[model samples]
Target: MVLVQTKIVFHVDELNKWPEVLSNVTNVLMDLAQHDDHHIQMVVVANGDGIMGYLIPSINDQISELAKTVEFHACHNSMVSHGLNSARIPSGVHIVPVGVIDLASLQDNGYRYLKP
Candidate 1:
């Protein structure tokens, strides 16, 4: 038997409102992973002010549960550039070496990209 999984990467570069992010991520989780056992692999890569979304409790709390299963990556270089630190990045998010590089590599690896 062949096992196939869907790989998706969502890139959040700007500080988007929580509604859009929550809706898209929830849709991916609810529509893809929860509804169908299609083996969904998802990631959220955030850079710039976009990282703020992960810091705020109102936003972070909403998705904290999903973080247990979903991959949430923050950009180390972006944090440095923005004068922010990883300590403020919330509990479940990880720090990638660089956000843009991470995005490029994911795309190269055949992950579909979404900007919401």
Candidate 2:
């Protein structure tokens, strides 16, 4: 059996430009998915206004499809602080307890870190 391992951590804190950041991150993620690196995951730690901005979806449909190959994780701490629940997260979003955890686990597994 082959084990696919590669992770990306996105620590998003800024509120204003987060939307654009998320969109670009989505693009890179899609690119990774389509590339030889088939196993790619995205851990998005959104705090403060970052939560609102991180929800943007990728533009290209192929990117959206490729996104399925990537795991999208949201920081639960932000959600709670923002008074948001799993229901509040847009479609295709996964909620994690915190970015710290996302880093410890996913990063330990060879996931790269991205600020956007």
Candidate 3:
């Protein structure tokens, strides 16, 4: 049997889309759990107004739990634009220099892009 690794990058730019994005990530992880031959690498990149979601206590808690199994990225540019400093970001989430550019770089490195 051949093993396959799937890399996925999820882009979220709207605050309201956080729930949907979380749901999508949960579903993907569940689906991947059943497939023994496939390995998954997932990252959720938040930019634009979506960065505000990180400031929400409830959402941050949820994201913190999920961070154990999935990667989370916050855009530095967006954070600055929204008046958020690095200290405001959750513990496990990474801060990227630029969201769109990071997305492009991930795609170039073989990660499939998903927006919800």
Candidate 4:
């Protein structure tokens, strides 16, 4: 039997959307886990003000929990623009040169784009 791969990239650009985005990520993972025919590759990319969520203790903890099942990415451009440094980023989160470009590249490679 062949297992199909489903690639999904979640984009978050606003700080206020972290809760919703996290909820959506949890739901998506749960929904997909019920099926065995597909292998999932999920990524959450935060840019703009959304990267600020990583500095908040509460949100950061929540993200760290989900990081075990979802890959997390932060935009270096956004961090620099907001005067944030690598030390402020939570563990398990990757630093990307640019969020928009990364999103485009993922989509071009057949990963579905989701903004929540």
| Top candidate, metric lDDT | 3
Report the lDDT tens digits of candidate 1 across residue range 7-113: 88888878765558667888877776444537778888888888777767787887687887788899998888777887888877889998999999999998899
lDDT of 2 by residue, 2-112 (tens): 656566777766666555655766686657657673665665666666775544543224224534555556678887887888776766767777757776776677878
Best by TM-score: 3
Winner by TM-score between candidate 4 and candidate 3: 3
Compose the digit string of candidate 4's lDDT tens values, residues 29-94.
888889888788889999999999899898888887888888999999999999999988987899
For each candidate in turn, the TM-score is: 0.86, 0.64, 0.95, 0.93
lDDT of each model, Cα atoms only? 0.81, 0.64, 0.94, 0.91
**Clash number for each model:** 0, 1, 0, 0
Worst 10 contiguous positions by lDDT, candidate 1: 28-37
Model 1 per-residue lDDT at 50: 85
lDDT of 3: 0.94
Alpha-carbon error at 95 in model 1, in Å?
0.2
**Model 2: how large is the Cα RMSD against the reference?**
4.4
Ordering by lDDT: 3, 4, 1, 2
Tell me how far candidate 3 lies from the true structure as C-alpha RMSD in angstroms: 0.9
| Predicted structure 1, TM vs. truth | 0.86
Model 3 lDDT per residue over 1-116, tens place: 89999999999999999999999998988998899999999999999999999999988988988898999999999999999999999999999999999999999999999998
RMSD to the true structure for each prediction, in A, is 2.0, 4.4, 0.9, 1.2
